[model samples]
Target chain A: MMAFIHHFTKTYLMWNEGPMIWTSDVLILLTSIGILAALTYFKKWKWLWTEWLTTVDHKKIGIMYLIAALLMMFRGGTDAELLRTQLIQPGMKLLTAEHYDQIFTTHGTIMILFMAMPFIFALFNIAVPLQIGARDVAYPYLNAISLWLFFFAAMLFNISFVFGGSPDAGWVSYPPLSELGFDPGVGENYYLLALQITGIGSIATGINFIVTILKMRAPGMTLMRMPLFTWATLSASIIIIFAFPALTVALALLLLDRTIGTHFFTIAHGGDPMMFINLFWIWGHPEVYIVILPSFGVFSEVVATFAKKRIFGYTSMVVSLMLIVIISFFVWGHHFFTMGTGANVNAFFAFATMLIAIPTGVKVFNWLFTMYRGRIRLALPMLWTIAFVPTFAIGGATGVMLAVAPADYQYHNSYFLIAHFHQVLIGGTVFGLIAGMYYWWPKMFGFKLDERLGRWAFWFFNIGFYICFMPQYALGLMGMQRRMFTYPANMGWNTLNLISTIGAYLMGIGFLFIVLQIAYSIRYGERDLTGDPWDGRTLEWSLPSPAPHYNFAVIPTVESRDAWWEMKKQNRTDEWKVKEDEIEPILMPKSSGRPFMFGVAFFVFGFGMVFHWFIIALVGILVVFGILAHRAFEYDDEYVIPVDEIKHVEVGLGRL
Target chain B: MTTQTNHTGEAVHVKHSAKQYIIGYILSLVLTAIAFVLALGHAMSFKPLIIILMILAAFQILVQLFFFMHINESDGPPYHAIGLGLALLFAFAFALMSIWIMSFGYHAQLVS
Candidate 1:
């Protein structure tokens, strides 16, 4: 019993790590306590439970996802600042090499998996149903499950900082390095288990959105007539469903290798690490498209709206989007062109990678054409969209440069590679998501974010982005290898690295301005009394801002592409108003605590697995299955909002 | 309660009889048993036996799709068919690419 206790304390507690961990533990503890105290003091637990946690409403789920994404961005951004600060000067001791490894790993993982994925999902939940003119997602309860699983998985991953330790074998967790022979700690286990849980959630979300978009569009809203964002969501969902399984298989096998001594990726026993790389990139390459495609969707919507014109070549845009999706799967080998896959294999992948540039270039031209010879409004969202085009163009051009297999040998693992990705990811995905948040802010809330503050945030972030990453390209060309904790001053990387670090801080400041913008807007921003704030063209704008929980009292019949715009043009906006006699009871999925409980159970199972506590893991699995069985057998899972109540809500919202 | 509104405003009340399920179950079982028996009996050389097993597996997949998954029934666009086609295409592509890529790694003598 003593030995068991000692083992548990040593492996799981991780109390003796250092001051950095101790500070994190204290901060996390205090934050939790403060949040609990505030919730109690406000007497809002019941409100929280009924309105947010147990909600099967897609809007509320989207809001929750948005909040989580923003918080994760703050976390990920902080990690970036720390990394930059560490490399601000040669041999800076702000962080030890060991700590730097963990931070960079978490930074990449959190930014991509937690930040980008949730940001996109939040947009998916918030906009897809609304844009498609549906009341809710096709599987609302399953949607709730997906959200909770992601939340809990994120919590599980973050807690590794205070508990077992963060995964330090980079975000990819490539094998041989990630194998038990080298990394015997529980950190890699945390990475695997957390990713596995979230991966399942992501897959369910993909399936849900596919079904929702495919089947739930309003009458006459054909596939081609659907909003570009919805189309993007559909394409991204397809990619998600196809791509995420590869990640699942890769992570699961690595876990098996860690826990059960498998030879799948082990070094000595006929295990091939290259297979892991191949499988990971098979998912990984398409995964970038999955995130960025949605941003492309956002840009299309924003450009069309601000340009006061229909999107230029809408069909071509969609064809190109699908082309990118198909091509994404074939180019995973470009990620490891230098891994000695032979000339023929490398040339094929390189060619496929470059082929992506054609569709992407077409999209850039389409956006430009959308804005050409049209009245352009410079709304905050539009500003981000306009910024994205030139930024992503340069990023895409650099990406093509890196796609050359022979040249990749020079740029591989260098600051140039890092700069290229951060360019596309931040310049592309982050910028687009931020634009989406601003575009839909009034739709989610009833008020617009403060424009002046948003502009400040935008310029700082955008300028800081160029200042930060542009130098890294030069640094990469100067032969600075990535993942290095520090450098010698004689290497002449000091000036560029210093400038990059400064730019990172500026971006951090910009992020702060955004938070301030949001906070100030909540109290003093302009109210969006009219739903069509931007003179938007999509079906979502047809409904009132902060639309009632039932969304549309009567589902609007879509007549053409840009259905709402068409309705407005025809002066038929009153079609949303329904007579008292026309009101019908609406069936909505019931609020249940099951998803949250299931997330908790999965968390327990994951945590137990991380620690190799078989008994605890078994109990968790049993509880998980028990909940599933209960859910399956239970038939009464939905409730109806009576006609009278919906009428009352419509009257209150002045939609009667 | 028995009828649900589909995408096209029609109420789709899909009902399946236990007989169909039993038939599907029996067919799946027989297919599996035949594959097992052939393998266990070593009834033919490796190449032919593998080819026959592959054929049986394909048939089993079709049976499952038609019987259990109800691939043909739809109220709107054939999303299920499109999804299935895409899935099969991706699966085949992934398998072929993995083999092609891994073969190169083997040729290069990168991994054991």
Candidate 2:
């Protein structure tokens, strides 16, 4: 019934959408009111702890980011499922084109901007600080703010459904389609404002991570000595710093065009649509690395740990990751092979795209060699890692094919491209994240997840993913386009679509099993965590289960690639520290409700201004300046950690 | 933690500081004001002025990076690496803008 209302409202708006809300908008209005109403009744509003929200602790922020991202994933995933079902039978009338439009757009928006990003960030929050032997990220309060801003953006994206409708202009929101005369709905408004908001948060987070990685390495842990995960993050964060601002500028330009008609990308007004495409892909191409490279890092660590071998070719792996970053910037043109840039341009980009495979292949070989001649433990995480290796390679092979300029003509906009991305994304990033979750679950929480349940989850998920996506390559070859809600049954796509949908359900069930495993482990699972339960190689495994707010009592130094392993081998020396180093009172940022309030401000200003709420926008801008001004004059005057206090704390390390 | 105290004379330091940020901002602001005044005053003859201001702004961002952002003063990685990092971002943005502009095939100059 709700879906029907959403569907009906969307079609009506497609025909006659306005700045104002229609009657169906009231349903969204009512549902949002209902959700907020429940929050009020339960008084969970107070439990929204401003103290916790603004704290500098990476773990808390990472977890919050994950929670927000999960909500987005659910919202995005449901949209996907709906689209798939609509596409199952041609001209089936299950959903109108407008309804399909909203689903596809929101799915891409939420998945990329919200789900994948925050999930990767969750791993960063949990690992980077701990891995680098830093007590906290470089700017912890900023970290908190970045997370809240992201949440605000995610919330604003969803809030569109309530106030009016969400972005139906597609995730890319390509113009003239996005211009006022064409869309002129709250849909594109949400797209610009939400993305602009989230893009700011992402950019700031990128800077924060990059600074942390560069500056906060433990003494003796030079760039060369850093862990693979840290190295991957360094490269990824570099991409983010350089890349996301292009998105920010692009979205800003588009917003200017749509809201005020400034003629940036409009064809009639001296604007260039190809400009938008170029800028978007400049960010978009590296955005793939932003997701995939971190996953590669995750798999490296997993393979090495389970294989009980030193990561083979550590220097080469780091060098390769760096090379990947350098090469990625030159390859943005490959995205627009269909734009008719001529064969020379196309061939140049095509070759650049394939060059990425070299460093990527090096990293792959290094991982495999790490596993060679070692006692390979077939842990669930390791199983996923193994499956991912071959699967991602297949995706890479297809990617190379697509990079061939002539071949891309046949493959562009087809299900083949879709199949290629999903193969890599699911097989690479998704699998790596799942592997990290399993590998670190016991380290993060006190208990180990049920291995039996983990195995079931793995097999089902791995098999189901292939079943779903492998057929899409063939579908692409047969000339089936993506984003079609319905196809002519004679086009030979119905069987593949049906099979894909079935596989999606199986994958869904597998996810459920994993979720169940996490839930059960949280409650009744066995707990024996003196924290280093896995006998892990990294410093993160040295800390207690569910690590404390202050991560390290004494910032541990490095003697070798595996700092913790080196410590054990050397018989637990204070060689972890430099000689005459006196413990200064390590100052941590104070917890304030400021980040949340600032986030609220951006939230109101972004969404409200998009809808042209003059007064609300005014208030929102005031709130932002108000918070920043209030924050600037004050300081974290609370000298919270005293020197003797830290020493005492260090003695009781693992107390958390 | 240390400044370039190795500068031979107080006049040299004073001159570098004066030219680096203080005059840099002034010159940038003047060029911008000139461009803005021309545009606002409706003078098509000041197309040269617009080009001049943009070039000035681009240089100003560089000046600020070197002096205010403290890039050129230090010989260490902090100075060079971060400068390089910022340069990389600039290069990517510049490359993207160039491609975008060129893609329209001189059609932008034709856009009203």
Candidate 3:
């Protein structure tokens, strides 16, 4: 009986011997309880479940993604602050080495996978269909499944912190170190299965967006006439479809090696770790572009609308986008030049890497020319766009410097490399997403984000970004390495480290201000009566702010590059207008609890596998398949919105 | 709720006869048999055997894509063709790059 109790407690509860609970765990517990209590008190469970948990509406799904990404950002940000605080003084023993490893690993994984990917997906959901004048994505039910899969995967990864151990082999999870021989924890198992689930969802998203963009565009909207955002979506989805398969294969092989004693990546059995690196970068490098391309598309839209002119070199912009896509795959080899490939191979990759700058340079000058001799508004989104140019240029220039194979030998794994990537990622992707959020805020909700607070956040964030990373470049030159938890006091790295830590705090404050701004605006901000709040040049602005579930009453036919702008110029809103008798019932997919139930089942399966409980895991798998079969055989999956209901809703909103 | 519309009476889809499917299946089986016999008999040297097997595999793929998958039946949508072409291009690139880089590096290591 004692032995049974010990085994049950150790395996099921994951009760480590000493100090098993942390402040973060307690905080998570309390926050969850508080949320539950509030929901019960307000009697909002039914509203929450029916409206959000089972929603198939693209906009609602996007908002759910936005909320999840923000919560993850806060979690990842706390990890960053902890790192900064520990590094403030030399030889600080605030955290143990083991804990430090887990912190950085989770930080990298959360920031990139959980935060940025979902943030971009949120924008894609809210904006893509609207921009192209489609009523919904091609596969709305599949879209819900994708969101729930990603959500469950993220939850599975996060609970690793409280339930067992966190993965310490870094976000890349390179082999030999991550293998069971060196690190034999269930942490890496969680990483593998969780990523497999999310990766499958990501692949589905790629296919969904690709089919939608290609097939569902309104009449006369030719490929060239498509909005830049849609073009970027198409390009990025292509990359996702092609690149994610490499990740799927790599992860599957690693899973097999760990679980079933395969030699796919095991070094003792004649496996090569470099092969893993190759496969990883094949997916990883393209992933970097996948995150950045949609932001580039956002920048294009913002630059044109704010500048009050046609984008300067539209053909060149499209060409540059495609060129980036083609060139991205050829340059993945540059990531490992220090691994000692032959000079001929290194030279080829280096040249290919540097060639990316040429197309990027064309885009920079095009943005500048668009703003030249044009009426440029200094709106909040435009402010971010204006700041993005110089910062990203510096980032791009440093990128070329590191692309040199010989020079990269010195900068490899140094703070300089860290600084270079953060510059591009934070400067390029983060800034552009913020710009898009602020620009589209009025459309997503009925009110605008408070501009005064937004500018404060903007300046603090931009300035804080520079102050934080610019010195890391110098620190790298001063022989500082990354992933170092502490340093000796007399190494002359104290002052700069302190300054960087200070900058990190300022950025934290900037994020906090944005959060407060959101809360304040939701209650007291002025509402947008006219949907075209910004005098925008896209199809989304043609609808009312906080657009209806069915986006357009009548499907629009495009006639020019900037379709909405052209319609406004010719006063042709009447052209596509439907008479009262022309209104017909619209078919929409019915929302079901299947996706939410699938997520719950996945969590159970993942948790069971983490504990090596094969019986529970098998049961979970069978339940999942049963759900899929149930959905397949049930053909009554859609319902019609009657014409009278549509008329009543539109007339009430004065949109008729 | 509105009554369901019956579109079954409206249009006729093209129907291929059973003979066509049977012929395709028989041809596929014969090609597989020839490839297997050649491999088992050792009728050619290694290099020629590889080339002949590759050609047979290509023929099988074409037959499946045309007959079973109905690639040509997708009418007026050039995007499908373009997407297929792009996918094939990337598949070849992935395979060739993997082989070339690994073999070249392995050979260099051996020489060293």
Candidate 4:
């Protein structure tokens, strides 16, 4: 008992790490305390628990996802600034090499997995069901479960920094180096388990959205008539369904190798580590498209709305979206072109990788044609969309350049490669998400964000992005590798490195401005009295701003592509208003605390696994199964909002 | 109430008897047993054995899809069929490509 306790204290507690960890611990403790105290003082605990935590309403769930995603973005952006600061000057002792490794690893993992994934999901939850004219997602309870799983998994991954250690195996967590032989810490264990838990949520989300889209559209909203964003969500969900299992297998096998002393990806005992790389990239490549495709959808919506035109080449846009999805699967080999899978394999992948650019180019032109000869509003969403064109074009061009397998030998693992991906991911995905957020913010909160502040934030982030990443291409050509903690002054890399650091700080400042914008807008921004802000085209815009729970008292029958726009054009805006006799009781899934408890159980299980505490882990697993059994046997999961209540709400919204 | 009509007002509920489920369950178990016996007993050469196992697996998937998943019971278009077909295609591609890529590593002696 004493020996076990000693081992646990020495390894898991990690009380004597350093000042950085101690500072993080203190900050976490104080911040948590402050939140709890504030909630208590404000007497808002029940409200928080009932409305925010337990509610299965998709809009409230979406808002929670948005809040969580923005926080994760802040965390990830801080990691990026720290990395740039460490690399700013030669021989700078700001961060140790180990710390640098951990930061970069966490930065990549957190930004992609926690930040971008949830942000897209936020858009999905907020927009897809509304646009399709559904009261809620097909499985509202399952949707809540997905959110809680993601939340708990993110917490599990985040707390690793101060508790034990952060993963240092890069975001991919490739084996051999990631194997227990080399990395014996619990950091990789946290990475594996946390990702596995979150991956369950992601897969559930994929299945949920697929069913919701395919099965729950309003009458007359045919497949081709669906909004571009809904189509994008469908495509992304398909990719998630196909791609995440590979990740699950990869992470699971790696976890087994770590915990149970398997040889799946280890060096000895006939284990093949290269297989791990293959599996990782198979999912990794499609994972990029999964994120960017939604942004593509967002840009399509924003451009059409701001330009006051129907989207150009709608058929081709959809064809290109699916083509991108299909081609994304075949091009995983491009990530490891220099690893020498032979000439034939490399050539095939290079061709496939370059082929993706054609469809992507088609999309770019489609967006351009959407705006061509049309009135452009230059709203905050439109501004971001405008900036994305040139930036993503450059990123895509460089991507094709890197696809040439022979040329990749030179650019492999260099800053140039880093520059290319960041350009696409940030300029494409992040920019698109921000545009969508701006476009939907009024619908979400019933108040528009300050346009002036949004533009300020936009310019700072956009210009800073170019300044930060464009120079890195030159640095890559100059033979500066990524993940390098420091280099000597004589390499001619100092100037560009310092410039990149400055640009990164600018982005940090831009993020702060966004925080300021949101805060200032809450009290001062324009209220969306007319739901059709921006004269929007989709069905969501036809509903009230911040649509009441049980979203549409009577779901509109979609008639044409851009159903709401067609309604507006025909002067049928008041069609949704109904008489008291027309009102019907609405069925909604009842709120339950089971999903929250499930997440807590998952967190405990993950935590126990990370520390190798079998008893705690066993207890957690038992409770998880207990919850599942309870949910399965319990059939009274829904309730009806009576006709009177529906009428009252409609009258309150002045629609009756 | 558990099988309420959707927004499209289609009868989404597909009735199945316990007899059908029993048949499916027995068939699945038998197929699994055959695969297990073939593998354990070395009933054939390696290539032919793998082929037979693959065929069995395919049959198993069909059983699961038709009997369990109710793929043919939809009132609308055969979206379930299309989705299942796509899923099978992707799964096959994933397995085949993994083998193709990893075989090169084996030839290069990188696996050792």
Candidate 5:
């Protein structure tokens, strides 16, 4: 028992670091305590538990995802600022090398996995069903499970900072360096296990979304007639299902190498580290598309809706998206052309990498032509979409530059690559999601976000983005490699670094205004009484704002490509009208605390595995299985909303 | 209270019999047996042997999918089967590429 206690305290509690308590650590603790106190004081625990923690409703789940993504963005943003501050001047003692490594690694991992992924999934949950005129996802219960699993995996990762040391072998966690001989700590263990768990959730989500989009779309909604956003979701989900398995295999092998003495990626045991790299990028390259493709979907919707144009070249847009997915897998070798994969092999990948630009260019032109002769709204979402075009174009241009096999030898691991990705990811995915949030805010919550404040946020973020990354491209050309904690004063790299840091701060301020905008809007924003807020083109806008619990009172029968637009043209508002006798009781999956409870169990299980406590880990796994068994034996998993109750809801919402 | 069956406006269900499952099982077993025997007995040259084994494996998968899994049944929409087929294609491509890349890595190491 004493030995067990020793292991627990030593391996689990990072609070015992030293006499000096860091300010950030104290802030994290205080913020958590303050949140709990607020919840307790307001007596909202039950409300939170019933409405949020156990929600199977896609809208509520989407809200939870959005909140979590925003919180992760804050954490990742802080890490970014810290990295920037450390690089503000040469010979700065702001952070030690080890701390810098941990910060940057966490920053990258959290930004991509927690922030970008959840943000995308949040949109998926909120919009996909609505766009396709479905009542809910194909598996609402499993949807809750996916969200909670993501939450717990994220918690497992975040707790490493306050409980144990954070993973420092970069987000990629390349082995040999990540192996036990070098790391020998609980950090890489946390990285592998957290990713392994979350990755399963992601795979589940992938399958769930695929089935939902394919099987749950409304009557008369043929494949070609689905909205662009739905099309994008389908393409992205396909990529996720295929690509994520490689990540699962890679992370699992790395875990075994770290824990049970396997050598799948170790240098000495006849294992090649190159294989790990190969597997990582096999997932990693498509993963770039996985995150970005959904954003592409978001942009297509935003551009068409705002431009008041039937999306030009709709089929071509879909073809390009499919083309991107196909070509994404073949270009993983471009990431490692410098490793002497032979000229022929490198040439094939280099050309394949460049081939991506053709389809992407087609998409770009499609969006442009969409706005050519149409009345453009210049709404907040449209502004972000407009900003995305040029910024992502530059990113694509630089991407092609780096794809050159010979040029990559010079540019690889430099700030140029950094600039390129942040340009595409931040400029493309971030902008697109932010636009989606703005566009759909009225639909999700019956109110418009403050456009005045939104404009401020957009300018600051866009300007700050360019200011942050553009100089990095120049700095890379001036021979500044990435991940360096500090440098000699003679390096002449201080000015560009300072400008980049300042721009990062501006972007931080921009994010702050968005927070303020949400808070301010909650109190005083304009209410969207009419369901059709943006004069939107899709089925989502046809429902009342804050759409009724069962999204469509009647599951809408969609007939054209732009189903709602066509309905409006035919003056068909009565399509939503339901005859009194036609009303059937609606059956919905009953919400239960099982998914959240399972999350807690998995967290405990993952925490135990991280500390190598075999019995505790086994117990956690058993608990998870036990809960699954309990759920399985239960037949009454759903409840019917009576016709009278549906009528009551409709009357209350003025939708009858 | 009347027992009201909820109608989601999905297509009518297509039920299958136990005989279909039995046939699928038999077909899968036969294909596996052929591939196993050929590998053990050296029934063909290496290249042709691999090709035949792959063909047999493909047939086995189709039999299982169509017969047992009911890929043809449109539970609501027929696109579920299409999605699965596409997923399988991508998976096959990924596996092939990983092998090709890894083999090339090995070859490069040998030459150097």
Candidate 6:
């Protein structure tokens, strides 16, 4: 009764006051408190705050990132369900336009920013070091710090629903619309602080992966010889390092505009709104590739593995990804074709956008060849990869259509555009992430997700996703604009809308079973101590289940493609011995709470700015720096693995 | 960070001293001033001025990559990756700005 009342009150608070979260806030707040209390009740706080939050171990940090992503996925998915419900009947006013605006806004924001980005980051953190046969990333402390910063940012974004309003502006949070005078609510401020806080994490993550992939590869694994996933990870990191700083500056300027009344992006005080668009899209353009490139890399691995072939076009796939990264930066202006820049500008952006499809099309062909005729396993992960090509193609085709400037005018700001992006984005990036979870679950925790339930998830999610979104494309083509409250009933739209809503609810049920599937597996999943449970091709599967603190028994020499699988076939797991004599005490950085504390302080300052608490914000800034400075000088806290212990642990054999 | 197998173990030593790094910083300042002066004259003719500044920027980029970033030749594959990264940045610069400046008048209005 008490929990129900608490949920009810939270929901009431959410609907009555949480601005952008107008309707979603209630459930999210209760869930947040529930999460906190549950962790405390289970005495998991110490484990979470210590072993997870402050740990410099790449694997732990990766798990934390995924957990954060999972929680936000629920939040975002609920918002999706709500929006679908609103469209169930054309004339229904179940959710007001104000509520609807916040609903879709939060849905997009939470999905793309909060969910997809972290999921990619989590994969990078977990896989990169292990695949290279390294114990940890080049800068493990920085890796932990980055995850903490992201978590802090995510927490702040959610907490805003309780303390104040959420941003109701679109995910892009365009200028003029986002200007303080125009949006007197606290919502955009929520958007600003949350993203800026997370932006720090994103930048740090970029640097961490760059250093890890660049600095920490095992011997003989040359750049060309490195896995394609590593290449894609490195490319994506570089994009983040350069791209996110642009967003950071833009958000900071917006923060200044909102609180200190600066002129960075103002129409009133000699500020140019177009500059904001440029800044936002500069970040926004690269962001598309940032999310998808890693997934592209993942799909390549997935297709090759399931087909029992060497990746068919490795060189071309890498080249295509590299080209896609470059082209991604150039296409930001397409988002603003409606801003009336010029015909020449539109045509140029349009042309640039169309050219990208060529490389992307090449990637599709590569995956197709990988699956052409080899012994195909319809594993859940493979099923996703198989389904993704056709789905993302449809999405990509619609993207090219949107690129046509004259046609975009009709589609711009309509549900049609929304449908298009959600298709490519969800189908392309999000599905890849889901597939990744299934593919790598064994490697991450030494247990596979139950295939029976897993298959159920795959089919339900895949079919339900298309059912939910395909109709939206039709609805969009029917001249329905996005972000509206209610539509007239007799417009032939109700049936499709009803079917789409049913699809969403079914997806929700499908997702629930998936979660149960994971929980059940964690409790009773079949354990394979020998890591190559899937006959894995990568170095990661060579390691033991629940990999050791020092990943490799001894850092091994990587001499070929499919390094581990080759080593396994050659019976050379013992070859790590040749280098074991040279092994000295291995040093790993100690876990420190300073980074998490700094993240908290940054959040405090961010909140202070949101509420116009000048002194509090100032203190918050100081606290952040104070934590950073304290971190810079400490050199003595690392743990060392003695040579004797190394030998005891079969130093002759490398795990992967 | 260059990934490397250091059998010699002390493979990443650089000949440049701290004083050389300081000198590099000073040289950067002088180069920046020269670029700025060359740029001011060509403000109205941005094409030439931007060309000059970009050349200067390239010099700065190389200086940082070689001196500051220390893409350690003895270490790993990072040097080539960094070079490729720079090349990609140039591609983005050309691709993005060209789209901005060259295409300015055809079907810019999307609110039909």
lDDT of 3 by residue, A342-434 (tens): 776778889999998898899889989999987999988899999999999999998999999999999988889889998888888888888
Off by over 4 Å in 1: A1-11, B1-8, B40-43, B105-112
Stretches of candidate 6 off by over 4 Å are A1-45, A571-584, A647-656, B1-112
Off by over 4 Å in 3: A1-20, A574-578, B1-60, B104-112
Supply candidate 1's per-residue lDDT for A89. Answer: 84
lDDT of 3 at A516: 88
Model 2 C-alpha lDDT per residue in residues A320-375, reported as the tens digit of each score: 99899888877888888888766667777898899999999999999889999988
lDDT of 6 at A555: 69
lDDT of 5 by residue, A244-358 (tens): 9999999988888888999998879899888888889989999999999989999999999999999999999989998997888788888888877677778989999999999
lDDT of 6 by residue, A1-656 (tens): 99887775564245444344543456666877999999989999988877776787888888888988988999899889888888889777667777688777788888988999899998998888888877787777777777877887887787755556567888888788888888987778888988988888888898878877776777778777788788889989888987887788788898788888898788677787777777788888889889998888889878878888888888898899888877887787798888877776778789999999999999999999888888889888898898899999999999999999999998897878878988889889988888888887887888888888888887788888888888888888898788877789877888888988888988888788789899989888888777777787888877776677777766677899888778778988666433545666666667888877878898888888777778998999999888777876775757777877766665333431
| DockQ result, candidate 1 | 0.41
lDDT of 1 by residue, A1-656 (tens): 99888886566666666677778878988999999999999999999999998998999999999999999999999999999999998989999898899999999999999999999999999999999878889889889999999999999999998888889999999998999988888889989999999999999999999988887777888899989999899999999999999999999999999998888997699989989999999999999999999999999999999999999999999999899888999999999988887887899999999999998899889999999998999999999999998889889988999999999999899999999999899989999999999999999998999999999999999999999999999999999999999999899999999999999999999999999999999999999998889999997887788978878777778889988888888998877567788777887778999999999999999989998988888988899999999999978877788998998888887778
For A1-656, candidate 4 gives per-residue lDDT tens digits of: 99888776566656666778778878999999999999999999999999989988889999989999999999999999999999999999989998898999999999999999999999999999999988888888889999999999999999999878889989988888899888888899999999999999999999989988987888889999999999999999999999999999998898988999889987679889998999999899999999999999999999999999999999999999988878888999999887767877889899999899999999999999999998999999999999999999999999998999999999999999999999999999999999999999999999999998988899899888988998999999999998999999999999999999999998988889899999999999989988878899999998889999988888777888988888889999877656677667777889999999999999999999998988999988998999999999987888888998888887888777
> Least accurate stretch of 10 residues (summed lDDT) in model 4 chain B?
B1-10
Rank ordering of all candidates by lDDT, starting from the highest: 1, 4, 5, 3, 6, 2
Model 2 share of native interface contacts: 0.05
Candidate 5 deviant stretches above 4 angstroms: A1-11, A15-21, B1-7, B14-68, B75-81, B105-112
**Candidate 4 lDDT score relative to the true structure:** 0.90
State TM-scores per candidate: 0.97, 0.88, 0.93, 0.97, 0.93, 0.88
For candidate 2, what is the lDDT? 0.78
TM-score of chain A of each: 0.98, 0.92, 0.97, 0.98, 0.97, 0.93
Model 4 misplacement above 4 A: A1-10, B1-7, B105-112
Greater-DockQ candidate between 2 and 5:
5
Better of 1 and 6 by TM-score: 1
Q: What DockQ does each prediction reach against the true complex?
A: 0.41, 0.14, 0.23, 0.43, 0.27, 0.24
lDDT of 5 by residue, B40-72 (tens): 999989999999998998898899889887877
